[model samples]
Target: MTRRRPPVTPDQIIAHRRAHVISQAAKVGVSAACRAAGVSRTAYYRWVKAAARYGSAALVPKRRRPPVMPTAMSAQEVSAILAVAVAHPTLGARQLLRHLAKHDVHRSASGVQKVLVRHQLGRRAQRLAALASLTAADTGQLTDAAMAGPFGFCQAASVAGQNVSMDTFYVGKLKGVGTIWQFTAVDVATRWAIVALIVGDKTAAGAARFLDHVRAEFGRLGVPVTGVLTDNGPEFVGRDFTSHLGDLGIAHHRIPPRSPNHNAVCERFQGTLLHEFYRPFFYRARIDRIADLQTGLAAAITDYNHHRPNNGAYMAGRTPRQLLNEKRPAQSAA
Candidate 1:
């Protein structure tokens, strides 16, 4: 086998050539020194050229220059753009550009969007709203469940004491009338409901009849109700309706005007009843039959309260009857 060449070191090569140039000053030139050191004459000439152009430091390797800086924007300008993005997450780049232009930012929409995407500032508007809503509450009080959603209420007692939710729906066309009114009263705690099919009139007498029906149903269920909650409809807000509830020693709580979420439970249940029972039957019969409608309503309510599963955190996948049993075990245990 041929002899292996020794590993070359930069310092060794440089020093060896430098010493050869000094010691063999008369016998060797730069080309001869390179040949003896096992380096190419061309490489030696290149080094000499570089040294002449950039001094002895050219023989040492230069550090890499940092990458070019991207188009620079001031921190305040960036923050302003970010704030706009936070406010309107779903806004398109064009819209954002327009908004920025209105505020005198004077940047192209695509350019601003490029900045937003690079900074990961793009998102949907609702997500921002949800994030904003998550700030800590005042003091150390926990969030009230009733304030949360349809099933969010303060306590189990709030349901048992007197809190009620009421709503009205149409029972299709009645004889000589376009539609009949079906008023409902639901106990927030138990999910127990009392519904009445009344004539088209929304008079004090009709309100009284609904109250009487609710009282009878409450007695049958053996649950004492403390409050009656209804919308601000003229019939519900009248003096006659207030006096009737007062006479029964029950409090009346009117939901805030135009806030359907306040009476969400009753409203949701009414929709369910209309879909599952009333609509199908009315469509088939072509006319409302009071007796048949009443039977259907009773059956639907029974299915809803005892058999249907409540999809609320308070009920925790339990049926309304199971929840009622848990709340007032004495009656439910029987």
Candidate 2:
């Protein structure tokens, strides 16, 4: 059974407060004053405390419970750890943990690994790690651009809510739907992924719409978006696209041309989605295929977010949603 909530309005609250104040001035007992105001003694006292601290606006209903993140570290601490990961993209989880400890940020290697898994930093780490051990002799004949990727190693998102990596993947051309575009966004700190499928051309309008979808999704999840990482695709750099992002106060960071590694998280997910999602439908009959594709994509995404087992060393049996829920940061204390 669902319990009905009472409507709280300014007028109603003002009247309640007035009654409680009048009853108190009349030398009424605390319980009696609360009862006259249709509230409890505890609530009345809390309001009194609020009034003493924050003035009349304190009468507005306050959130009863604060947010919680599983770890003991603060947002700043998490950010610092991520900053290191972003800076040294080649570092393994154990190496990262040792690096952090060197700077007085003492966290177990498992903790650092969890952060890496949640951000899908494994691929970039592996790529850069291989390159890091290469000798000058090994690269002497190679061009600079051929050796180091464009934009080099980018920083990881410091805060769970701070940055999201966005990229567009081209699905095969459907008979009726023409070209299919999957615009994917993954939170740089959490592995939470969202994919928006489009049947039409991937235009500025489409990119803007996708950005709006990302904003709404993150908003519902209580994440504060700071920046979007994209490649120099026309869909992302067009006037409508950047303009919409600007309106929402979201910063746009475009990776260097020819450098998909800069947005490695989103890029890797595209491959995963292709294998885990689109491949199964490749041989299906074309009759009413778009609907089937839509349903299949939706189901695949649902499982990916909630049910899919992550095999990363740090993630083990957990899913993206589970990791995100566990590591979701709390609102800072007042």
Candidate 3:
């Protein structure tokens, strides 16, 4: 035998009907609102029974239970972890674990990974695929020009006693008002460099001034410049540059156009200058004062030639100055 459900009163039926009408009008619908209100149609009917037995208080809902505690890490700890990750984004989980260990945080790599995943901070697996798609493919073989030569072509051909290569770099932005150019000359075999900062357009006059500086250095060393090899820039090929070289009785050879490899010695030294001195000096002390910058450049060049090792030559154990001094005996012998 089955028990029968209690009868619903008129007041409860009216309240439930009113709720259903309002819910459907609000777009929540009767079914959704009942679910949200934690009441079934049967329960609504039971409330009607209560209303029949009692009054309007039967329509009221029961109190809801409190929410459960979250398993997520604290905000402070997450902030610290994020700060560390940002400072060294390239660090792997093992490295990160080691770094954290030093700071007294003992957590497994897998545990850290779980935390990262929970916070939506895990490295994307598709990032590597995207990187691969973006990278350029390595083409075929290198030509003779592209290949690194034995002792490099510049060093191999340039006898320590003779050849020099000259080049120029713009030191200032030409905002129409003015500009400065740095003209540099490097002894191909010895790695000795003479740099000059000239305030003006990179004209023939600027090149001539640089030549004069090189001439003065040659006088001190008591060595005559036999040949000067330079790129086919306007300043080097101009009448003033040619006439000055002619007066000094130095043979000038213009490198084949677009072939910097022929003058690789000077190019390599320029890279060293930019890396070891120019970049650091410019960063620490802004080159706003031209005179100070020039003085600093000169000192840098002196230090480079006298102290820096020359690894390109047979005299690898010696500095540029020491190699040049050694070259004097070889030149005298010749």
Candidate 4:
């Protein structure tokens, strides 16, 4: 076995080196001693002067102090901002400034945000995490909602196929094919995604047809979609789409007006699809027909579901297909 050595502190090393230099200077001269010690003559003289003026302890090196910023918030101000932010984790910086004013802690929204950034609480998700930790400490239990994603909207699907979030994305118009729209559906629990590219306008009839495709695809896998979540777009609220969902016995859920975060699962998936597949693929691949784009999209979605690792609340670090397989048996039992 290798013998363990005791740790040496920086101050100890500095003191030892300085004592060697002093002994060398007493034997030889200051110039020669500084050359042997590999230290500047000015530094050696400055150390000697400090030791003589103060005590021998002054010769030992001290850790440099952190520079204080003139515009930095005081401890009390930081505490006040954190308290208000934790109390209302959903509030934006401007809204938080109003609450801070009531407590006699005056600060601009940007200043408060700077303080939050300094303390690693800049994002609302991080603040919500801090609030969850406080609640857990006080109650010894944390709810599922508290552990959910940034908006807590994805928590609506507690099990696989419980809820499916659907949305429409506008892919750039093709020269020959005209306008193109991507109909995207993601399982809120497993994040299993299906996408279809339409060559024309995204009408109610088209959306309803996409819903049929989604149900049929999941049905083939022995998973029944229980609820459909969508934004308040005309395509979703129209009679054709509503009547289709009603006939299929699937409950239709609409997000609040102008609140896209309530449908964040679909929103984030669309962003990923755009960045990972569409952007790069369109940049290189020539699109002569809508059929070619649809085929490419289907292949990308397959890779996403089967191979790509997802870091979602439900997926952890597994692929959507793996998560779906793990949850399908339990869902059938329920």
Candidate 5:
């Protein structure tokens, strides 16, 4: 009858390894130790290799096959994506691909994201680095490295009544609906946000009305906004919008020409809306009217403020509603 080699438990193998190594240390060599332990020199050496590589956990069985399957993206493509990602950490993959396309380099968004994630250079990492730099500058560091990005290192609201930004954007060209305008407001401190659909052409009156809506919505949630920031677009600079802010006793600040970084939080939120809400909500479903789109926007924003993680510097990993609840006294004061 053929005898099977008895199963060697990880603990037994580990004990055997200690004996073998001890023998080697005593100038007895691994061979004598292997013989005494009923293990071959090959098994002894394999154990030695594994122990060196993985420490105590090496006694457990490991895969003999290849560790990781190769990715679909080529090494060259991944390198390019990573290089650009480190250079422009704020940009999304789709935007990154566009920048690469000019140089005849191409990569899918997921593949590019994989490269960024692998290197720990994802957007969140970038945000943290930027925030650190900003804090340093705020404490009078004044070095170029401290004041690098245009965002000026957007930190969360130190006080509950810090800056909030508002903006209007053109969503897309729907078949029968023409262009849909989306008005967005985001609290820089708390990452609390709200969205509303605008009908007809965008005007100063519409902008002002949207500001009022934002105030009421934020107020109801106990997050009274103190200051509002907007771009230098005609709708925002016109009398209607400024007058509306003056009436509300809210300070209004306008960004400089071609400087979106001044309003980076609002712009980033717009990108979030496009990626998380608009693309999936519109492209995947059947919608016939603007009213349907409106409902969809409302639903999306509801999920955003309550369920989604903001990942903002100020948020430090909390949903808007959670942050509000945690700071109820401060919000109530506002």
Candidate 6:
């Protein structure tokens, strides 16, 4: 059997009863009406005065007033919490509290969380976005003419070739060529990208070939590709790909299932290639040959890595090529 909820009389009914009591008082007397209505004389008088001043609508009961808590966070504390949260977007409230304390801003983890929630930054994603927005503003990327991207605060690579993210893009079928796949590899630190086009099917062998291309490209930069991160796709996880990485002495890192953001650096570069290069190039020029497309892709990659100013985190208004070149002397191009 379902349990019954406590009956709550509607506000209209209460207002009507109060109105009737006032009317009854007009007919008989105030004290008699109060006794009949089972209400105190003081309450009856107060309601009468309220109805007269604010109309009969005022006869309805009001909810209990909220009390102000003295222990609530101060404005400065809230500011500190928010600032710390945006600085370390990936950190939780407890982790952020320590940072806040470093700035001499003391607050409990729960208090910091409350501030975060109030500002609609309770989630780590929201915090990341806040950091991105802040970075965009700092880098002058956010303007009336152009707005910065969502991943503007992308994680910076500490060292070149330490971590390389790889992914496959299915570049639709051509009339002459059956199907084409574009394999992409991006250095996490410098955002240096390498694209290889494969006609027909994408296999583990193709992926391995792409790895070799990445090695050759980064090899020119004088940095050995140490680790390769990719999604848990068949081509990437297959024995052939694994064996190739082993042969080259490169570590293979696969992101967890259903988490595309883990390999987001590769994903972002692929998106940039699609929107900035392929889409625009295809719109103006017709390309039926894979070699022609590869030629265009190579030029686009060169422009992207060398010319285009990256506003992402740690870039400091510099291009990926600039960072890579700087790393050449130190031998840590990340």
The lDDT for every candidate, in the order shown, is 0.66, 0.71, 0.66, 0.83, 0.71, 0.80
Taking the tens digit of each residue's C-alpha lDDT, what string does model 1 give over 260-297? 77787788778878888887877777564677777887
Query: Using alpha carbons, what is the TM-score of model 6?
Result: 0.60
**Each model's total of backbone clashes:** 6, 1, 1, 0, 1, 4
Question: Candidate 5: which stretches are off by over 4 Å?
Answer: 1-156, 326-334
lDDT of 5 at 245: 84
Best by lDDT: 4
Show model 6 residue runs off by greater than 4 Å. Answer: 1-53, 56-156, 329-334
Tens-digit lDDT track for model 5 on 7-30?
988777766666456457457677
- The global Cα lDDT (0 to 1) of model 4 is 0.83
The TM-score ranking, best first, is 6, 4, 5, 2, 1, 3
Compare candidates 5 and 6 on TM-score and give the better one: 6
lDDT of 6 by residue, 289-315 (tens): 888888898899989988999786666
**1 or 3, greater by lDDT:** 1
Q: Which candidate gets the maximum TM-score versus the true structure?
A: 6
Candidate 2 weakest lDDT stretch, 10 residues: 133-142
Error of 3 at 254 (Å): 1.4
lDDT of 6 at 69: 91
Error of 6 at 143 (Å): 37
Candidate 1 global Cα RMSD: 21.1
Tens-digit lDDT track of model 4 for 1-334:
9999989988878987887887799899999999988999899888888878886788788778999888777889999998999899899889998899988998899999988887767888878877775664355344433444334443356556767999999998899779989899998778899888888899999999999899889888888987888889999999999998899899777777888887888999999999999998898878878888877888999999999999865467899988887657464645
TM-score of model 3 relative to the true fold?
0.50
